[model samples]
Target: MNLLLMVTIFCVMKTIRGISLQKSTSHTFEMQEKRFVRSLVNQARLLSDWTEWSACNATICGIVGVQERYRNCSIAGEISVHLTICGQELHQAKPCEMPCITNQAVSLGSWNNWGSCSVSCGRGGVQTRQRDCLQILCTERFLQQRNCIGQNTCPQWSQWQEWSECSRSCGMGGVKIRERSCQVRRNTRVTQVVVNDILKRVSSPRQSSIQNVNASLCEGGDEVAEDAFPCMTSSSCRRNWSSWQPWSSCSATCGTGFSSGSRVCSGRIGSSCLGRPARYRRCYSPPCWSSWSGYTPCSISCGTGGGYRTRRRECRGTSTRVPQYMTCRGSNAERELCNTETCPVWGQWSRFDKCSKTCGSGRKMRTRTCVSGICRGRKFDVVSCNYQPCPYWSQWSSYTCCSVTCGPNGTKERTRACRHGGYRRAPFMNSCVGEWREQTNCSMHPCNVTPPSVFDTFECGVRNRRQTNNFSSSLLRIFGGQQSGPHGWPWQASWQYKNCNRCSWSHFCGATLVAPRWVIIAAHCIEESAQSMNHDNPGDLWSIVVGMHRFNEDGERYFIRRAIVHPNYIYRDVTDADIALVELRSEVPLTTEVVPVCLPQFSQPTVNETCFITGWGYTGPASSVSSRLSTTLLEAEVPIMNFTACQMLSPLYQEHLNSTNHMCAGDPVTAATDSCLGDSGGPLTCQRPDNTWYISGVTSFGFVECGTPGHVGIYTPLISFEEWVRTTIENNTYAAC
Candidate 1:
C-alpha cells in the first residue's frame, strides 16, 4: 500500500496505507488537550457487542501528521474528541470513552477494519486479524453522516455507510462532524508543515466556524472524501479560488469583483464589485448606476453583483409638452429620469430605466437618475421614489408639462412679481428657470402672460367688516379658498420660492427687532435661501421690516445686509427652537415704531394657561398675501402635554426635544382667534404676575385651519437649549467680519 505522508503539525495527522512510523523523521508528538465533554444523549451504555481491538495498553491521544511514531501510535474513530477555547467549547462532542496512557507522549489508538491502523500479527500482520487486534491511526475523520437508526452498529445496507458515520447525522439540530477535511484541528503546537496547511482555509479559527460547519456536514449537506479533506486543493469541492490566492492582490481590470486580470479570467455572478475581505461573507459585485460616471459608471465584472438587474434609457420630445422616455435593460444605455413618482407613460422610468428627471419641451436638461426599476442592480435594490416632488428648475418631466394643473386655488408664473398688498406672508411662489430679464419694461411684458402670478399680492388690503377690537376677529381673515388664477404646470421656474415659509393660508410669520442690528423672526420662515430671493448666495438677503405692529400702515422698513437662518433650523421640519436673526445694513434707531422686543431671561408660561398671538394675516382669506401687515390679538390656553403628545400631531418634530431642549403648549383646543393667517415668528406671550409678557413658544407650525382647536400647534421654547442658542448667537455676533 502507498504510504501517504502528511506533514501536518495538527493534532490529527495520517500516514499512507502499510506505512510504518519508524520510517518518519520525528518521534515525540503533542497530545489532544480537551477540557470538557458534553453528551447529546445524557447517558450512553457501553454495548456488550462492542468490537474491541487488541493493542498495546497505551492511551488515546488525538493527533495527526506525517512523521508519526509507532509502538505508542494513536488511532482514528477510537474516541470522540473536543476542545475549549476562551470560555466556549470548540466542540461539545460526545462523552468519549477514556483510553489508557502513561507518559506525556501520545497514547496511540487504532482505526477499525476500515482504518489502516491494524494488520495480522505475523508476516501478514498477525495479532491483528481479530476484530479487537488491529490498530492503525492516521488523520482525523473529516466528514461523517449518521442516521437516527444506528448510534452503535453499521446499518444493514452497505449503501447507508455514507450516511451513518456523522458527528450528528440525526440533525434535529446538534453536533456533527463537518465535511471540511482541509480543516485542521489545531492545538497551537504543531509541526511547521501542519501549520502551513492551516493557513489555506477560508473560515476563521473561531469556535462558531467549526460548530456551524460540523452541523451542516453532519446533516449530510455535502461530503468530501478523506484523501481530499486535508489539502482542500481539490477544485471540485470548494466555492472559489480565494483560498488558493490568499495573499494575491486583486488584479482584475475590475479589481474588486472577479479575478478577471488572470490569463484565464474568472467569471462572476452579478455586477462585479470587489470581494469583501471578511472571513465568512462571499465576494459580490456593486449595484448598477443610473448615471454611470466616474467610478460609479464603470461596468461590473463577472459576478452577478448581488443578482440584481441593470437598466438605462433616455428621454426625447419635440411636439407635445410631455417628455418621451426610452428604457432598456442594459448597463450600456443612458439613464433617463422623470419627475412624477408614478409615470403614466413610462413603466419604472427610474434608474433601471435610467430616467430620473426629464427636460421640458427642449432637450436642454440633463438628469442623473435615482435607482429604481423592476430588477435590482449589483449593490442597489429596485425601489420607488421616496422623496418629494421635483424641486423648482427640476422639470416635472415625468408628469409632463401637460399644463401643470395646479389643484384649484393657485396658478403657475414665469416671474416672481407680487401685486399690491405685496405680502400678508402667504407663500407667494415664483420660479427662476428661463426667467429672462427682458429689456422691455412692465408696459411691454405686462405683469404676467401665459402662467399668471395670482398668489402674489400688492398693497390693497381686502375689506372685512367683522370685529373692531383686534386683527383675528376681522371677517376678512376668516374666509379662505379664492381663485389665484389659471392653474397649469410644465412649470416655468427652474427654481421656486414663496413669500412666506409655507404655502398654507395662515400668515404664520412675525417680524421683530430683537437687537439694534438684528431683525428677528421665526427660524422656519424660509428653508432654501437660494430660490426665495432669486439670490444664489444665502448671505445676500437685503432687507427686513420690523418694529411696527401692523403692515397695513407701515412704520418701518429696515434694510438688511445679511440674513442668517439658524443652522440647526430645519424648514417644514419643526423643532422646539424656532428663532432666526437678520443682520440689518444699519442699526435700528429704537423708537416706538422700531422698538426692539426682549427675549425672556427664562421660561415663565405655565401649563393650561392663556397666551396671546399677533400677526398681519387676513381677517378674511384673500387671493394674495395680506395687503397690509395686520396684527391680530387672539387667545390660547396651554394643554400642558409632553413632547410626545405634541409630536403625535406632527412627525417633523420629536427628534429634537429633551428636558433641556423645548417645551410643549397650546390648548387641546383654542378659541376662534389664535394666530390665524401670517402669524409665524410671532411670540406666544403669556402675561406674568410681574406684568411682564414673557415670550414662550414662537408661533411655528399648526393645522391649515388656523385658530380651531384639537389641532395642537408647535412653539419653539426660548428656554430649552437656551445655552446653545446664546453661545451660537454670541459667537456669531462677535465674529470678525
Candidate 2:
C-alpha cells in the first residue's frame, strides 16, 4: 500500500509540474490552473477549516502588503481524480495594514542589568529591566526579562504557636490569633563558605567568602507567619436575657384590644433562650360621649338675646378582659345658642311703577316700608323700564388744523352732533350732553424759526434729510407692516444678540436712543437674549446698532457698559413695568442718521391720537421670535386706544392693562396695525402740538399672532416713569460720560 501511494503522489506531482511548464494564452493558462487545483482530488478529498490569517508580510513601517491563510485537504481513497469535494480554493489571501513606526532604522537597545529575583531562594523567579526609545517610536519592546534563581539559604517555617486568649469573654464577636517565627536550626559550629569557582571566574575572582551565621541563616522567606480564627469563651456560649420592656399601646382604638411587651437576647447568634422573650396582654378603652346627637329646636324663635338648644349623650362601655371598670368622661347633656341674628324689619317690596316716558326708556317709582328702619338691604329697588331707542351724541370729528401755524396763540377745534341712531337730531334736555363743539390751545413751533439740526446741536426729535439710494421717503403705515426709509427714524436702535461669546450678532430686540449714552429697551429682552450678559463684562455680550435701516449697512455699534432694569419689572408678567435702560461704553455722536428721541411731558396720549412704532421686528404673525425678523427697519402708524376700549378688546388686556403704567396702540376695528414679536423695546412716538415727536411709550409686549383684531400691542408708558428716567440719567451722567 505504501508503494502504491508513493506512485500515485509521484504521478500527481509530475502532472502539476507539466501544466505549470506549458506557458500559453490567457484562457489556456486559466484552464491549466484549474486542472492543477483539481489534480489533488485523487490524493486528498475534503479540505480542513481555514487557519487564522498570518501577519502582513511588510516589515517596514507604513508599507502595504498582503496576508495569507491555508487549509489542507483530507486524505481519500482516490489518487488520480481532481478534489471536487473541496471548496474552490485551499489557500486564502487578503490585503492588510502595516504597523507605522516613526524611525526608519528601528532596533532594540542593549539588554539592561538583571534585576533582583522575585524570590530570594529556590527557582522559577524572573528579573526585568527596560530602556527608553531613542526616536518618536520603535517596533521592538522596551522591556527585557530572563529567568533567575536566589543564592541565599531558604528559610523554613516553625510550627504555629498556641492560640492567644479570646479578645472578649462574653461575645461571639471576639477573635483569636496565633503566630510563628522563622527560627534557624542550631549548628555545632559556624563556617565561612567560599564562592563557587565557576561563578568566581565569571565575576570578580577576588570575591571574599561569606560567613554562615544565625542572622544569615534564614534570608529567603519572611521572618514570621500568622494564622487566625473566630473564637468565643464559655461565658459567650451561654445566652444572656434582658429585662422585659414596657407594654406598647393597644392596637384597637376602643374596647377590647391586645398589647405586647418584649425583651432583648444578647449572646451567641441563633441560640435559643430558656423562656419566651415576648408576651401579650389584653387591654380596654371606653368610647367617649358616644358622638353627641344633633341639637334640638330653640326654646324661643327670633329674639334679641337669641334662643338656646340642648343635646343629650349617654356613657356606656364594658370589657371582659379588663378587671378595672371603665366609663366615658364628660357631661351627658350639651347646650348652645342659636338663631341669634336680628329679625327682619323691612316688609315685602311693593310693585314696580309705570314707565316714565312713552317714547324713550326711563325709570319709575318703587318703595317698601322698613320697621324701625333696621334692614339688611335697601327698601326700594328699580330696574329697566321701557325698551326704546334714545338720542345720543355722535362721536367727535377729527380736530381741525390750528388757526395759526406756530406759537401759543394757535388753537384747534372739533365738533359732534346729537343723533338718534344714524339720523341727525336737534339737541334737547333728554339728549346726552347738549354741548358738542370743543377747542384746545396748540403750538407747532415758534413762528419763523427752524429747529436746530441734531448734528449742529444736541436737539432731539430731529429727522435726517441725508438721502440714500434704493429707499422711498414715503412709507406705508402698518405695525411691523412696512419697511422704513434709510434714516426715517433716527432714534431707532437694533438690539443685537449672539449665540456664543465669539459669535456674530443678530437682531434680538428693538431699542430707542433716549440720550447720548443711554438707550431704553424692554426688560424682557435681557432675559430673552441667547447669550447671558456677564455683569462685570456685559459689553462683550450685548451691543446696540443704530442709524442703520438694513442689516447689511455698516451702522455705529455701542457696547453696553451697564443695563438697569425697572425696579418693578417682573419676568413673564405682561402687566408689570417691563422697561430697562442700557448705558453705552461711550457717548454716541449726534449725526443726521443718529439722534435721541424727546421724552414725553404729558401723563397720557389723547384717545385716537396717531403715533408711530419703529423696529426690525417680524413683519407677519408668528408664534415666536424664532421666525425671521425684518431684514430692514420698519415703522407703522397706530392710533392711541382708550383704556376702556383697549381692555374690552381682549380679556388679557382687561386683566392686565390700566391707564397708569401701560398704554395700548392699534386699530382695534381693522386689527391690521399692531406690534409683533421682536418689536419689544422699540419706541411709540407721537407728534405733539409742537410738531416734534415725543416718546409716549416703550413697546413692551403684544400677542404672538401680531396685528390681530382685539389684540392691540401694549406699551410701557414713559409718562409714568419720567421721573425714574431723569433720576437714573442724572445719577449716571458723570460716570457714563
Candidate 3:
C-alpha cells in the first residue's frame, strides 16, 4: 500500500486506540519502511502477474508481533518491503489461501486448517510440492510478514502515520593479530636462506638437505601484514618480501627440499633455499638448464645454403622483446639454435640522420620513424641501418634503411644493441645455429621486439585501450593530485647533471642522469648490439638515446659507460625486484628539463605520513606511458612493527623487518593500494614539514597482473641501506661545477 494511504490507515488506527503517533528518532528506515510499503504495493500492481489484487492493503509489524515495536533505522531508501505473489505463486497450494494466511490467524487454526494456515501466512511463505510430483503443497508463514487484505484495502484507516525508532548494533565482527602469536617459532625452529638470490635459485644437488633451516615465523593472524594477504586462519601470514611471495599449504608447515622459509614464490616452479619442491608450481621446463641441458652440438641437417644446425638451449637475455622462451613456448623437438658468425648488416641514411634497423625472417622489420620532423611515425620493411628522421621528401616518396641509432648532438649511440642472426639453427634457443636448410633459432631474439616507435603503430592502441580505462577508474589513483607543475620538469628533477640531446636516435626506455658523466637505466633496454635484415637481434634496441622522448627519433644519445643490473634481475622467479643501476657514457647539462631530484638523505624520514610517485605510464590502464613524465601523490600513514609483525608479512625479511635490514610501512585496515603499473622502479619520495623530500621506496614490485583490493604498490624501502647508494655514486657525482 502507498505510504500515504498506509499513513491514513495508521492514523485511523491510532485515533481508534486514542494513541498519538509522532515522528520517531531520526529514522530514515522508518520513513523508508513507509516508502517500501508503498513500493511493494505498486510493484504488486505493476510487476507481478497477480492482477486480482492490484491494490492490496497490508499491516507491517516487526517480528516481535507488536505495533510500534521497531526502534528506528538509519539506512536510506525503502525500509518496508512488499511481497508480490504471482498466479503461478498461488495455484499449486490449497490452503488454497496458502498465499494469504495471517500469522495470528494461522496460530488459531487446527490441523486441517493449520496446513491451510501456512498458505500466504502473511509473514513470509514457502510453496513446495510434496514427494509425489502430482501433489503440490506450499507454506508461507513468516512472523515478520505483513497481512494484505482483499482488494488490497487498508487494514485500518489509522495505521500508516505511526513509526518507531530503532538502532543498528554491530553485527558479529572483529580480529586481532597480537604480536606474540605470530612469532615465527624462530626460537623453537630452524631458519635458513634458500631462495635469497634475485630469482629463486633452482635447488642445486648440494642444497637439497632441509634440517636446520630456521623457518621465519609468521607472528600474527589478526592483522594482515604489509605486502601480505589476509590469512584465512589463525596460524601464520607473511607479506612484502625482498624476493618472496606467500603460498598456502595444508600442513601449516613447509617441508624440506621445499620452501621451508615461507617466501611464497609465485609464477615459476622450483624449490626454495632448502631445495624443496616449489611451494606452488607452474613451471614445466626441466631444472638447471633447458631440459635440453645435455645438449651437444649436432649437425642434424648440416646444410650449406640457408639450412642450418645448432644446439638449442635457454637464451636468457633481458630485453623488451618477448623472451625467446615465451616465444618458443611448447616446441621441444624443434629447439632453437643459431650461427655464431652472424652479424646484422647495416645501411645508412645521410651518414646517421635516420634511426633505422631491420628484423626479418619471419618477423616484419618494424621501424620507428619521425613522420615529419615531429616524433610521429611511419615504418617500412627494409634492411638494418641507423634510424634517422625521414627525408623532407620521405613523406611518401623517400624511404631509407638503418643499422644503428645515432646521437642528437653528434655523440655516440647511448644504448648499443646488436642484432645477430634471426634464424636459429637450434630448436628453441634464440642463440646460435649452423645451416642445413633452416631451423628456428630459439636463441635468436627480438621475436616480440618492442621497437621505440611501436606505440605509434595503429593496432597497439586498439588492443590496450581498455586497460587504460581500468587504470583511470582505479580508486588508488584518485587520491593522487594529477596536476602539472612549477616543481621543475621530471626529466630534470634529479640533482645530478645529464646530457641527452635529441638529435639522432629512438627506442630508449627510462634513464636517470646520475652525474655530469653518468646515467642509469635498465640493461634490458640495451641488451642487443645490432642486427641484420630478415633477422632479429638485441642490437636494434636503442643506444641510450637520452634526450628524445619520442621513439625512433634522435637527440643527444649518450654513450653507455656501462649497464649494470643487480646480478639477480634474471627474468624468471620473483622479478618484481629486478633493479639495475646504469652508468652513462657522458652526462648532459642540467637544464630545466634534465635537472635531477636529490637522492634521499640517509636515515632521515625513516617513516613518514605522505609520499609522492611519478611516471610516464599511459594515461589509461593498458596504454603505454606517454613521452612526458607525470607525477602523483601517495600519502600513507605507516606503522612501526617488530620482528613477527614483519616476518608474517614475508619470510625473506625476518632480519630486514627486524632490527637491521628492513624498514616497513602501511596498514591493512586502510586498504591502501600501492603503485600498480606505470610506476615501477620510480622513487617513493616522502615529503616532510620542512619541504625536504626523502626517497623511501623504490617502485620495486607487485603482482604484474594486478587488481587485488587492499593490495598496494610495493617499493624497495630505502632505509635498509645507506652505504650502498652513497658508495656507488661517491666519486662519480659532483655538484654543478
Candidate 4:
C-alpha cells in the first residue's frame, strides 16, 4: 500500500476512539493499523542511479566551485506510522577548480613610442623607449635601447681562421677546429684588443685591471672561446710508395734460399694503405740435413747379447745450380748402441695407487722401479680415473623490470641456483659460491615534477593536420625519413642565424615551442653563437621561425628577447645538461599552424613507445658544411631504449653514457634512422594515450655517422632540469609588447 492508505487508516482509528465504538471494533482498527505498519516496515525502498554532475558554478580562477548530482527514489510496499523504513540518499555535491586565465590588459606590458633621437640625426645619437609594465602586474623587462641612425660602435669579428686539418686521418670519426678573434673597433681605427683578455688577465694584476676596462667596451662578450665542427675523410686511400730498403743478407750459407725486403706507403700516415709492403726473392744457401730415417726393427729383441741400431738421413741443397759450390755441413748418418750386456729379470708390478679425487674427473697412477738398473720395460704409469660430475652454479635469470619509470626509488632483481649434472639437487644447494638472489638499483634518473599552472601560457600538445598514408611509420634516426606535411609539427621552431649578407636566414638548430613566448633548445647552440659574437648576448643575431614548413618560405618570425641556459651546462660540451629556454620579443599569435608542445609529465615513455623527431638537419652522411641539411622538415619514428640496451650498442657509448640526464633512442636495426648535424636542439616528441604529444627529450648529440645501425641518438631527457625550465619561463616571460 502507498502512504495515502496509511493516513486513511490512522484517521479511521482516531474517529473510532473519539466515538463510543465497541471494544471489538476499536481492537479491529488497531489490529489493521498494526498489520499495515508491519507490511511497510518489511518492504524495500529503491533509488535510481545518480545523474551526471552539473558544471562548476564558478568560472573565475582562485574561487571555490561546486558540482552536484541527484537521483530519484521509489518504494515497493505500503507505509504506516508505527515502523519507519529508511530512505536512500538522492543527491551529492563535490568541490572543483576552474582552469587558470590571465587578464591581458594587466599582464601584458606595452612599450612607449620611441623618443626623438638625442640629436637631430647622427650615428652617435641614441633613441630609447621605456617598457611601461605595471611593476605590480609584470616581472619582466622595463627598458630598451636602439641606435638612432647608423650602427652602434661594436667589436668587429675577424675573418675565421682557416680550418685545421681533420683530427683523424681515416674514417668519419674526426673534427675540424677553427677560431675567430674579436677585434675592438672604435670609430675608423681597428684596435688589436684581446676582448676576452685571456693573456692579460692571467699574466699580471696590473694588466688585468686595464683589460677589464677595455672588455666592457666590446660589443657582445664571448662566452665560449673556441668552435669545432665534425669532419670526414675517405676510409680508403691510394697507396703512395716509398723507396725500398736494402735487402737483408742471404738466409742460407751457400745454396739458393729466400731473402725478403720491405718498403713503406708514406702518404697520409696512419691511413689504411692497400697491398703488401714486403717482397721475397731466391738467394744462394749451403746444403743441410733433411730428416733421419726410422731405425731398423730393434736388433736382437728380448736379447742378453749386445746389439746396435743405425739410422741414416739425406742431405738437401736449396738449388741445383749451386750444388757444386754448396758443401754439406753436418753428417748424414747417426748410430746408437742398445740392449748392451745381459738383461736382468723383470720384477712383478706393485698394486695400483689410490684414486686421486673423491669426485669429478681425476687421475690415478701405479709404478714399479727397475730392480738393478737393468730392466728392459716401462717403470712408471698413470691412467684415467674419476668421471663423476661436480656441483656448480647455474646462469643467472634475466632481471625484472624496474619498479618506476624514472627515479632512484626503483629496483630490479634476478636469481640463480646451484646445480649438479645440469640439474638442481639437494646436495648442490649449498655448493654455489655466489648469492642465490641479486638486486640492483635501476631507472635512477631524476623525477619530473608537475609545473605550476601559471606557466601554462598557451594551448599545447595539439596538432591540426591528420597524418596521411605517406607519413613515415617508425622513428629513431631521421636518415630514412619522410617529408612532413604542412603544419604537421606546429610546435617545430627553427633557430636561424642572419647570414652575413642579411638577405636570408640559415637554420643551424631546431627548438620546440613550449609557450607563446618561450622555447626549449640545446644549450650548445647558444654557446656556439656567443663564441661567434663580441657582445654578451647572442639572441640579437638569431631569429626563431615558427609555422614554416619549408625553407625560403615566409613564417611568423620573432627575435629572442633573452636566453637562459641550464646552470650545469658547460659551454661547447653537450654531453650533459644540454637544455636552454629562450623568451621571444613578443607573444606568437596562436593559430592552427602555430602552437606549443606540452612539457613532459612525471611519467616517462615506455620502452616500446615510438617517439618522433622532426627537423631540417642533415639526412645524409655528409657534414653540415657539405650542404647536406634538408631544405624541408623531415620526420622519423624511434623507439625508447633502456640504458643497458642503449649502452651495449657501442663501446664508445658505454664509456660516455650518463643514465640520469640522457635518453637513448633510435632504430637500432635500421641504418640512417638517426638525428644528425643541424638536428641538435630538436624535439623528441612522444604521444600519450590521450593523443597529445609531449616534449620528452631534446636532441643533444649522436654518432658521427649520420645514421649508422647500432648507433642510437642521445637526447637530454629534461627530468633533471624540468624545474629550471619552468622557473625560467615563468620568471622571464616576455612582458613587453
Candidate 5:
C-alpha cells in the first residue's frame, strides 16, 4: 500500500507541474515547491486509505483488479500508474464481462396507519407510520413521524360550604372560612380526582392529556381558609343609633326654662340601646329694663307753687344679649314734686324822698321789702327828680388888647364861660365842657411879610450839605449817622399801635406824609400789624406819629380814621402796589417841622438817580430785632437801580418784583446804604435840578438784616400811585392842624 501510494503521489505531482520523467534528473527545488510536494503526498495517503484496488485479465477480475477496471472505465481524467511485476507484458486496465446490480430500482410495501399521541393535554405529541422494502433480496424498512393536537377537559372545583361561627367576641377581629375540592366525573362513578388521574383514565388516544384546577375553600367552620369570605360580629348583637334632633324653643321669656331634643335607634325591632331617647337643657331669655332720665324744669319760681319733674326709661339690652320687652317689669316713667320754696313779693312804695341834688341831674329814692322773708327778687328802685342840663361853653367874648406890639409876633386873648341853657342854674356846678380861654396870632403893620420859599416851608426837603471827600468813609457812615437836620425828614411818619406807649416808636413801622391828613405807607405793614393784633376794629389799633426825628421824643400823634390799603397788594409776599394811605382823625399843622413831602409826577424820571431814605430804624445790622432804635433820625443816599438789573441780582427778587409799580435802590454790591427793618413805609425822596425834592418811592422791604452785600432794597413807586394818593386824599376830609 505504501509503495503504491508513493508511486501515485509522484505521478500526480508530475501531472500538476506538467513535468515529464523523461526530461527530469535528480534535482533540488525551492522550499515552497518542496512543501507543495509533501501536501500532495498527504492527500495521496488519504485517498489510498479509502480506495479499493483491482486487477483484471481476459475473463476474470479480482477485487483489486475490479477497482482498477472501474477507475479506468468510469473516471474522465488522465491515468498514470507505476507497477513492478515479475514477467508479462504491460497493457491498459480493462473491465470484465460480469453482470452488476448496484444501481437497480426496488419495490416498497404498503404503509401502516398513524399511531396514538404521546401526551393528551399540552403542546408535545407524536403520530407514526411505517413501510417495508418489497424486493426478496432487500431488508430495509421505512418510517415517518407527524405532529398531532390533543387536549383533555380540566377538573372543576366544587362550591364552598356556609361560613362557620366567629372565633372571638370583641377587640381584635376573628375569622371564619368555607372549604371545597377540585373534582371530575369518572366512568360508572363520581370521583374527587386530580387532573392527571383523569387524563390517564380517558379512552381517546389524544384525550389523555391533563390540566390543573384551582382549589376552593371549605365552608361551615370557624377555621380561616385561603378563599374564605369574611364574617364579622360580636357574640351578641345590639341596636344601632341615629343622630340627635335639633333643640326646641325656650319655655320662658325672662328667667330660666327647659328645652329638649331626641334621637331614635336605627334598628326598628331592637330596644337594647344604652342611652336615653331625649336630652334636656336649661334655657333663658334676657331681662329687659330701662334707666331713669333727668328731671324736667320746675313749673313755679316762688311762693310754694308746687311743680313736678318726671323721668322716662325704656327697655334696652347690650350686645350679645337679646332684650325681652314683654318681660320687662319696671315702670317706663317716674315723677316727683319739685321747686317747693316760697317766693318774694314787693310791698307798696313809701312817698318820694327829697331830691339828693339841688340842680343838674339829681336823683330821688324809694324802698321796698320782700313780703315773704325768703326774698327772690329786687327790693329797691330810684327815679330822677329836679333834672337839669349840664353847663357848656358859650360863644367866645371879643378880643382884648395885645400883650405887646412887635415886628416879630404877638399874641391876643379872648374869654368865655360855661352857661346853662335852662333858666335855673345850680350854684358851684362844674363845667361839663372844655377850657374857657382861647389864643390867636396878632401882628403889627410895620413887619415885612414875605411868603416863605418852598424849601424853607418844607423842612424835609433840606439836604445835608456837609460833603465828604472820602467815599469809603461816607459808605461806612451811611448806616450810622445822627439827625441830618433839626426837623430832618419831617414828612417821615411812624405807624404805631394805639395800644403802644408814646415812647415806643421803635416798635412801629414808617410812613410818609403825602398830604396834611393822608400819609403813604406800605400796605403790608398795616396788614401784618392788623393780623398780629387781630382786633375787632383795625382803625382803633393804628395811630400815626408825625413831626418828630427822634424815636423817644414826643410828636403829634393822630388816630387813623381810616386806612386804605391797596386792594391788589398781597401780604404773604412783597409786591407792587404795596402803598396804603392813612386818613388821620385830624390834619397835622403845616409848619417847617411837620411839612408834607412833594408827590412825584407820573412822568418823573427816577432811574439811576440818588434818593434818600429816612427812618427811626436800626443804625446798623444786628442779629435780632433791636429794641433800641436810633434816637436821631437815620438818613442814607442810594442810587435807584433799574428794574431789570434788580431782577437779575436774585431769583427771589425776580419772582416777586412788579416793575410797573415798584422800584429798587441801594448799593447792593457794596454792603453800604440801604433801609433796614422798621424802615418800611418811609420816604425815598429824590431832588430835581430845580432844587425841589419829590417823593419817588415808599420803602417796602430789603435784606433781612439790612446792609447785606449783593442785596438791594425794594420800594413802592410813589409816582405810579400818584392817582391813587390823590383820589384817596380828595375823598376824605382833613381836620384842622
Candidate 6:
C-alpha cells in the first residue's frame, strides 16, 4: 500500500509537470509549483520513516538528474544526488542503477499572468507566479513573489459620523468628537487584487478604531448636551429691545436733568450678556423768558405822594408757548419812585356872564385863570342872577263842560291869550317854550287794568325785524340756515381792545353776557392780550361791545372794570382752565336789545343735547379777520359730545381736553358748521323745556383751520365752574348784576 501511495504521488507530480508546461499565465505556473513543492516535502517525510526498503549506491539517472556513482551505500545513504528542479537541486539518494542520467541544468517554465493586487489605491501590495520541474527525484520547489501596482487607490476617509456627546456639561468649556472608517474600492477591471484582500495585506498596526476631533468643530458643540451645561449656567440669555419712547416731560421746566434709555442682549439661552442694560445722557431745558418791559405810567398826576411803575417777565418754552411763571428765575416785575411834581392851582373866580334866561329865572357863568399855576382846581363857575319875572300865557279859563262821560271818546276846550293885566291883553306878548293851547287824548284806558306778565317786557325768539334780503337769504339757504339777523343774539358780546389797529373793528374775541354787569371770557384770550402789550392793564385795553351784531356799527361799549382770570389756568401748547370773568364799569339796560343769558344749574343735560353757538366770528374757515367778522350775529346748532369721544376725534383734542373743566360740542360731519377763529369765549346756550335759554359752555378753542370734518370744538363747561363762578362773583366787589 505504501509503494502504491508513492507511485500515485509520483504519477500526480508527472501529471502536474505536464499541465504546468501547457499553462501560459504566471499565476497557473505558481500554483502548480506550490503543489509540487508540497508533494516533495511529503515524500521526504515518508522516506525518512521508510521500514521495508534498502538504500543503494549507483549513478541515479534516467528521467531524473545524474550524479557521481557511490559504492557500499546504506539505507540512509551518504551519497550526494544532484536532482535539478527549476534550476535548483535537492540532496537525496535511492537504489543504484536507478537509471543513470546525464548532469544537465533545467530551466524553469515560462511565467503565468500576475494575480490581483492586494490594494485598490495608494501603495503597497504583492503578486506571485512560478514554473514547474518535471522530474520525480527533484526536490526543489519552483515559486516566486514580486511587488505589484494597482490601478485602484487605497481606502481613505469617505464620510464622517455624527458628533458624539460632549465631554463636559455646565463649565467654561467642553469637548465633542466624531470618527470615520477607512474604505477601499475594488478595481475589478484591472489586474489588481480584491479590496478585502488588499486590506488584509496592509497589516496596519493601527487597529480598526475611532479618531478624536476638537468638539468646537461639531454642530452645537459650544453647548452642553445635558441640561447641566456648566458654561455660564447661572446667567440667562437676554432678549432684544425695542426703540426708546419719546423722552418724558422734563422733571422741571428748566435746568439740568438726565434722560435714560435701554437696550437688551441678543444671545442664546444660558449665555451671559457682558454689557449694561441702560444708557443715559445729559439734557438741558432752559426757561424761555421775555425781556423786561418798560415801566408803567405813574398812578398820580400831582401830589406829595409818589407813584410806582412795574415790569414783568414770562417763561415760554422752546417747543411750545407754555406760561411758566415761577420757572423764570429772575424777578418778573419791579417798581420805582414815580411823579413828585405838584400841579397848577386856579386863581379866584371872575365876574359871572350876563343873565342867560329870558323868563321866570336865569343863570350866569364865571371863569378864572390858573395864573399862579400852583393848584389843581376848576377854572370856571356859574350862579343865578336875573330876578324879574316875564309875563307869559295867563291861566286858561275852565272848560265850559264835558262833552261826554265814559263813552268811546271825550273832549274839553279852553281859550287863552297873552295877558298884560289881570285879563286878556295884546297878542304881541311872548309865549313860553311851548304852544299856548294844547289838547290830548283823554280816558285812553279804562279805570280797571290788568298787570302784564314778566315775559311781556321783552321779546324772545324774534330773530329778524324784516324779511332777509335776497343775498342774505341765499347765504342762509346755502349755509343750512345758520345766518342770523341784527340783534338776534342779544347776549352775545364782542370782546375787543379799545382802538386796536390789527383788526377793522377792534374785535378780537367773543363773550357771553351772563349778567347785566358781568361777562364771561376765556383766560387765554386775556393772557395773550396782556402778554402782547407787556405790562399794560388788561382792563384798560379791553372793552365789551353789547346789544349789537355788527362790531363796526352802533353798540353799547362798556369799559372793563377788571378781568379776573382763573388761578389754575395754564397757557401751554394745551390750554387748561381756560376761563375768566370781566366786570363792566357800568350796568347795561336789560331791554329787548340787551339781555342776560341764564346760568346753568348744578345738574345739567346729558350728552348729545342740542345747543346753539352765537358769535360775530368768521363766517368760514378761510376768511380772514377783517373779511370774516360777521356784520350780523351768526348762529349754528351743535350737539354735545362725550369727553372721551371728542378726545379720540383728533390728536389736538387729546392734548387740550381737560375732562374736569371742558366739554365738546360741534357738528362733526358738517364741513362748514363749526365755530372758527375769533369765536373763542362765545356762548354755547341751550334752551330748556320752559323755552328759556341757559348758558352751558363758553367756547375756549377749536381747530385753528376751523370747520374740519370729524373735528369738534372744545369749550369750558359752565356747570363745572358753577361754584367757581358763584364764589368769584361773591368775593369780588367789582362784579355786579
lDDT of each: 0.35, 0.67, 0.33, 0.67, 0.59, 0.58
Model 6 agreement with the true structure over 11-66: per-residue lDDT tens digits:
66445434433444555434334333333332332112223334344343322222
Scored by lDDT, model 5 comes in at 0.59
Write the residue-wise lDDT of candidate 1 on 237-292 in tens digits. Answer: 11233432343333322112333222222343211223543332222222222454
**Segments in model 2 whose C-alpha atoms lie over 4 Å from true places:** 1-457, 465-480, 528-530, 572-575, 623-627, 735-737
Of candidate 2, the 10-residue stretch with the lowest lDDT total is 193-202
Candidate 4: stretches off by over 4 Å: 1-452, 466-478, 530-539, 571-574, 623-627, 734-737
Structural RMSD, model 2: 28.9
* Model 6 residue 668 distance off true place after TM-score fit, in angstroms: 2.2
In terms of lDDT, the poorest run of 10 residues in model 4 is 78-87
lDDT of 5 by residue, 592-695 (tens): 66768777766565577777888887677756454356766667778888889888888887787777767888867786787877788888888877776779
| Residue-level lDDT tens digits of model 2 in 95-177 | 45454446477655676777788767667677767655566557766655578887654555556679777644553333455
TM-score of each prediction: 0.29, 0.37, 0.29, 0.37, 0.37, 0.36
Instruction: Count clashing residue pairs in model 5.
Output: 18
RMSD of each: 31.3, 28.9, 39.6, 54.3, 38.7, 34.1
Better of 3 and 5 by TM-score: 5
Question: Per-residue lDDT for 1-737 in model 4, tens only?
Answer: 45556446545534533432233344444433443343333233444677999999978543457899976655554322221133234567755545443445445357889877654423666666665445344434454557676444556556757877865455443445555565655577777545332433545878767665554343333322224444447763334767788888887774566788998877544343556899889887666776789986557654555577889887666456764545566687777777665656666678778878755777887777666536766787777676666666655544556777556677778766656543333354235455678888776335685334544546789888563225454432337777887778999999988876766678989999998888898988887663363222444467799988887585778876667778788633335688888877567898988889888865678886899988998877665354477877888878888878888887877777787778888867765467778889999999988988889899998765767766788999966677788776665532111
Clashing pairs in 2: 41-82, 41-83, 42-78, 42-79
